[model samples]
Each structure stands twice: as structure tokens, then as C-alpha cells.
Target chain A: MSEFLGLYPYWVVIFLMMTGFYIVISRGNLIKKVIGLNIFQSSVFLLYISIGKVSGATAPITAEGFEVYGNPLPSVLILTAIVVGVATTSVALALVVRIREAYNTIEEDEIKDEIRTQGAGP
Target chain B: MTPSTDLLTALILTLLVGTAVAVVRMRGLFPALMLMGIFSLLGASWMLVLDAPDVAFTEAAVGAGVSTILGLTALALTARRAKTSSRKPWPALVIVTITGAALVYGMSDAPGVGDPAAPASKYPVPSYVERTDHDIHIPNVVTAVLASYRGFDTLGETVVIFTAGIAVLALIGGVAVSVRNTGPAGGRAGDGQGGDQPDELARGVEPAA
Candidate 1:
């Protein structure tokens, strides 16, 4: 039971990851797909942060009588990852807008249907 | 970890999972977007509980703040409710189940939370923690490592963000101009012909019609 308690967060991370994956695969809405991808990325962030944590340790700030500190490397790495995620999301949303403007619809099947009607070969 | 903190973490994780599930199940696009915002906020709080304040800060700012706004802007350009797909989702379900099982199998080997012997806690992490006060003098070792020790990587990340900003500006800027050019009275006709030309040029693709 204590073992489960110690590791429950990782299981939650996995569940979130699978949910994101399922949404990305099954959802037709482009914006929803982006949201799913964001969820996927955020779960990864959680995994890394959880790995970096040290029991009985405080935040990694230097001060008097503070010996134990959580690993700072993962936090720094995740900061970069979070910024990259936002940038990727913005670019993806821009592409979605462009797709809407050109295709007249954001639904994947409809876009494919339009392309087929136009006699555009896949 | 203390029992109370463990309980709090469990509660927060439950909220995160519930919000994520709700975001997936909600059909209304606006509500789903709002739920995504809530999801990010929960993720940020979870990060705070995990002892990663910098990550929590970035998650709150970017995930909850910027990404939600960007999603709304994109939705405004498109439709409100997502068009429901008629295709069967069985194949997706199978794939997701397989991937999830594989991930869970892999997790068995992962070190338990706060295991001091975990690879992440050894080597460079301890090195960084030890040398930070001497080399960077910053109170926050995360910032010191981000800005100094791994400065080049952060710079590369900044360049990537800058490029993305430029791409968005170029793509959306054309639409803004077209909207202004054709005012409200011109309406659909203005969108059909010349209004779309700039967008096509911006995308470097010919307009469909």
C-alpha cells in the first residue's frame, strides 16, 4: 500500500498520457488535437518533475541550514520544454487558421473530401 | 513525504485527471477550451507540489495564459462546435490501449519517487547543486543552471520561439490586413477574391478557387 502511495503519481501521468494520445488519434477537430498534444506534453513535464523531486527536500534555493535540495536540472530542462511547447502550439494554431482559410473547413475528413472533389491526388 | 502532503498530491492528481477526461469528453469547443485552461492550471499546481517552482511558473504563464488565448483566436478563425466524425473509433482505441499497456510495463522499472539513487539525483545534479553557490551566487539554482550552465541550450530555445513568433506574425498578419481591407459591408465577397490572395501568398500556396 505504501509502495502504491509512493508511485501513484506516475500511474496518473501514464493515464493522462494515454488520454492525450487517444484524443489526438480519434478527435477530428484540429484545435482539439492541439489541446490533446498539449496534454501529452504536459504529462511528460510532470513525469520529469516527479523524477526530480527528493523527499524531505525544499526548493533549490541556497540558504542557511538547508542541506537537501530537489534536483534543479529537471526543472531547468522543463522550463525550456514548456517554452518550446508554447511556441510549437502557436505555430500549429497558425497552421490551423491557414487551413481553415484555404479549405473552408477544419474537419479532417471534409478537408480530404474537398481535396478529392478538386481531383487532387493523394 | 508526509501523509498530509501525500493526500494533497493525490487530491490534486485526481482533479487533474478528471479535468483531462472532461476536456476530452466535452463536445462544445468553447467549454473544452476553457477546460484545457483549467487543466493547465492544475498541472501548474501539481508542479508546485512536486517542488519545481520554475516549471510551475512557466506552466501557469504559458499553458494557462498564452496557449488558451491562442486557441481561442484560432477557434474564432474557424467554427465553434467541432464537426462530429462518423468514423468508428475502434482502431484508435486499440492503438491507445496497446501504447498504454506498453507504457505501464515500462513504468515498473522506473525508480520510485524521491529515490536518492535515481540517476537524475546522482552525477551532474549533485554537481550542479554543489557548484551553484560558488559559480553563480544566485539563490535559485534552477535559474542559475538555466541561464548560465545551459545558456546555449536556452539560447537555442529562444531562437526557436522567436522563429515561431515570426511565423505566426506572418500568417495571422495577412488575415488581419485582409479583414481591415474589406470592412464589414464587403463581407463574403471580399473574402472570396483578393482578400484570400494575401493569405495564399503568405502560405506560399495557391488559393483553391
Candidate 2:
């Protein structure tokens, strides 16, 4: 029972990951895909945070009488990662905007259909 | 404290899972974005419970705050409701199931959650704390580690953010100016991001002149 309960965090992370993965592949909407990618990245962040937990510890700060602190390294790395994820999201959204300008639709299928009907020519 | 933290983590994780599922299942792109923000907030709560307050703060701000704003701005430009694509779900489901199962199975040998004795918390562990104290003297070890021990890494992250900003500005700055101000494709002009019902995929700001 401890086994099941203990790693529930990991299970949640995996579930979130798969949900995002499914959305990315199954959904043809480009915006949905970006959101899926967002979920996937956030799950990775959770995984890193989960791995850093120390029993009975406080946040990774040196506080009086607090002997243990969560690992600082993962938190730091994830901080950078979170920022990078934002950057990626913005760039992706910008690209999506550009795509809308190119093709009248953001639906992947419609965009493909537009390409097929339009033909791959200048 | 351990019990309460465990309960809190479990509760938040459950909510996070629900929100993520809702995000994908939600056909309305805007609500899905909000759900994604909720997911980030829930993740932040879990992070706080797990004792990574710095990461929690970043997640709450960057994940929930900035990401949502960006998603909103993007939604403003794109269709609101996601069209039901013709793609078969069975294959994706099978792939995701296999991958998830494999990861969970692989995790069996890994240390249990919050296991302080785990290799991750053990390695050069005290070194960071000790050095941050001696060299940096900052109470917030995360800040010290990020700005000092991992100075180059943070610098790289800044470069990445700067490049992304430039790319976005280059790509979108003109778009804001050039996109024909067609003004509200369908739904009520007051309703942004699908606050009302819609049968057709939102025809957002068309760039066609």
C-alpha cells in the first residue's frame, strides 16, 4: 500500500504527460498542440520537483532551526526551464500567428488541404 | 507535517490530473487554456508542498501567469473552438498507454517519493548549502545556486529568453500592425475567447488584405 501511495506523485506526472502527448498527436488544432506541449513541459517540471522532495523539509532556503531543505539544484534548473518554456510558448504562438497569415486556417488538416489544393509551388 | 504535506500533495496532484484531462477534453480552446493555467497553479501548490517554494513561485508566475496571457493573446488571433480532427485516436492512445506503463514500471526501482536518503538528495548535497552560506551568505539557497553556482546556466537562460523575445517581436510585431483589423469575426464583440456559444470555428483576425 505504501508503494501505491508513495509514488502517486510520479503516477500523476506520468498521467499528465500522456494526456499532453495524446493531445499533441490526436488533436489537429495547432493551438491545442501548443497547450499540450505546455502541459507536457509542466509535467516534467513536476517530476523534477517531486524528485527533490525531502521528508519534513521546508523550501530550499536557509531558515532558522530548519535542518533539511528540498534540493536546490532541481528547483534552480526548473526555474530556468520554466522561463525557457515561456519563451518557447511565445515563439510558438508567434509562429502560429504567422501560420494563420500563410494559411487561412490553423487546423492542421485544413492547412494540409490548403497546401494540397494549392500545390507546393511558389 | 509529513502527513499533512502528503495529503496536500495528493490533493493537489489529483486536481492537477483532472485539470489536465479537462484541458485536452475541452473543445473550447480558451477554457482549455484557463484549465492549463489551473493545472500550473495546482502544480505550483504541489511544488510548495514538496518544499520547492522558489520553483513554486516561478511556476505560478511563469506557468500560470505568463503562459496564460500568451495563450489568450494567441487565442485572440486563432480559432476558439478546436475542430474535431479526422485523426484516429486509437493509435495515439495505444502509444501513450505503452509509454506511460513503461515509465511507471521503470519507476518501481526508483526511490519512493520524499525519500531523503535517495541519491538525488544525497549527492554533494551539503556542499551547495555549505558553499552558498560561506560564499554567498544568501538565505535563499535557490537564488544563490542559480545566480552563483549555476551562473553560466542562468546567463544562458537569459540569452534564450532574449532571443525568444526578439523572435516573437520579429514575427508578431508586424503581425499586430499588418493583420487586417477585421474586428470580431463572429461571437459578440464583448465576448473574447469564447464566452458564448458558437457553431462555427472562430474566424479570427484575417490577414488577407
Candidate 3:
């Protein structure tokens, strides 16, 4: 059990990714889908972080006579992922606002019906 | 094989599985969103367990923080319940099941757990440990991998961010112009004085239940 314990990170990541994917694909609400997408993205962040781990490593800072420093690469990559996530959220929010104004309803089915009616020409 | 590590791993795995199930099984958007947030936090912790502080920090900030806010805001503005029925979802179930099976099968070929001689750890870890002075001066091998070997990927990522900002600015500009030009303030000829039937149709008529 102890030996298996070390694999917890990998298992957690897989679970989160699948869960997020399920939500994004199965959910009808745009907002819920976005939430799921965030979850999916976060799981990948976990995977990278796990890969960057060195056993018994301290933080990557130069201290006197310090030899065992943890990896900094995953953190840097995560920073980039964070920025991308923020940008995506902002754009998604803007799109939602536009959707609300254009369709007057955020329900996907309702929007589709409205579009269909418009396309049918009364 | 430490007891503390085993306990922590079990706890984290339980949380991860619970959140993942809740994310898919819960009907309420808010609950699912909240669960998803929990999942992100668990993922961050998992990263920390893996010694990836940077990834954990990003997951904390972006996944658990900004994304949750955005998701909540979007949910507030949108419909709460999805219109679709929460039933079997047979096709998805079948596909996911098959994929899971394949993944499990592939794992059999994977190296034994914690094999220090594994390809990943054998070369890079040793090289990184011994030759931190050359190739990359950075102490962190992960940083070296991202900024050096996969530098192009990092560059592409930066470009993608720039593109997103540009896209948002463009969207804002378009929206602003459409608002100004379509309204009475713009002085455009025949700008919405009639308030046509479509406009009336758009004015908050409750959909049939």
C-alpha cells in the first residue's frame, strides 16, 4: 500500500481529467462546461508538476551549500498555463455577455431555437 | 513507503475520486462547478506531493481561483439546469470504457513503479543531476526542459496568449462599434426607430416549458 501510495498523483490527475472531459461534453449549460474545461486543464497542470518532482528536493533557491533543489520548470510552465487560463476565462465571459444580449437566454437549446426561427424567415 | 506518504496519498485519492464522480453525476450546475473547484485544489495538492510547486501554484491561482469565478459568473448569467436529460449517455459510456480499457492495457507495458532505471529517470535525472553546470545553468531540470529543449513550445504558448488578447480587443471593438452605430447616438439613418417585431420578439418572452 505504501508503495502504491506514490502513484496517487497520477491517479488523481487521470480522474480529474476524465471528470472534466465528461462535464464539458455532457453538460448543456455553457458555464458548467467552462467549469469542466478548467478542471481538465488543471489536471494537465498536475501531470506536469508530478513529472517535475525530484525526491527530497527543496525549493529552487540558492542557499549556502544547498544541493538538493526542486525543479523549477513545471512551475514556470504552470505560470504560462495560468496566464492562458485567465485569458480564456475573460474571453469566455465576454462571449457569455454577448450571448446573453444576442439570444436573451443562455440556454443552449433556447439559443438554437431562436436561431432556427430567424433562419426560417417567419 | 512511508506511512505519512501512504496516508496522504490515500486521502488525496479519495478526494480526487469523489470530486470526479460528483462532477459527472451531480445535476446542479453550481454543485458541479463547486466540485470541479475542489478537484482543482486536489490536483494542486497532488502536484505538491509530486514536488511541483510551480504547477501547484498555477492550479491554485488559475484553476481554483479565476476559473471558478468565471464559471460562477457565467452560470449566474445563464440557465442553471441543462436542458438535456441525465440518462445513460450510452455512446459516451461505451467510448470512454473502451478508452479506459486500452489505457489499462497500455500500462502493462509501462516500466515497473519507481524503477530508477526507467528511461525518464535514467538519463535525464542523472544528466540533470551531474551536468547542471552545462547545457542549462538552471538548477531545476523542469525549467531547463521547458525553456531550453521545448523552448519553441514555450514561444508558441506566448504567441497564443498574445493572440487571445488581440482577439478580445477585437471583440470589444466590434461590440462597441455595433452598439454605437446601431443606436440613436450614432446618427445613422433609420437606426432602430421602428422597434420591429423581431425586436419585440426578443424582449423576454418566457419559453414554453
Chain A (alone) TM-scores for all candidate structures = 0.94, 0.93, 0.87
Model 1 residue pairs with clashes = none
* Model 3 residue A77 CA deviation in Å: 4.6
TM-score of chain B of 3: 0.72
What is the interface RMSD, in angstroms, for predicted model 1? 1.1
Ranking by lDDT: 1, 2, 3
Worst 10 residues of 3 chain A by lDDT: A2-11
Q: Give candidate 3 regions above 4 Å deviation.
A: A1-12, A52-79, A120-122, B76-88, B112-114, B128-155, B172-209
lDDT of 3 by residue, B1-209 (tens): 24786578678878788877777777677787787778778877876676666677777777778777877755654445555654457766666567655654544444433343445444445555456457777655566666786789889888987887787666555655554444444333324555332332212222221
- lDDT tens readout by residue for model 2, B1-209: 46777678778877887898788789888899989888898888888888888888889998999999999989878667788888888999999999999988888777888898999999877788877778997889999988988899999999999999999999878778654443334344436656554422243432221
Q: What is the fnat value (0 to 1) for candidate 2? A: 0.91
Docking verdict class for candidate 3: acceptable
Residue B39 displacement in candidate 1 (angstroms): 0.6
Candidate 2 docking classification: high
Of candidate 2 chain B, the 10-residue stretch with the lowest lDDT total is B200-209
Please, what is the whole-model Cα lDDT of each candidate in the order they appear? 0.85, 0.84, 0.64
Choose 1 or 2, whichever is better by lDDT.
1
In candidate 2, which residue ranges exceed 4 Å CA deviation?
A1-5, B180-203, B206-209
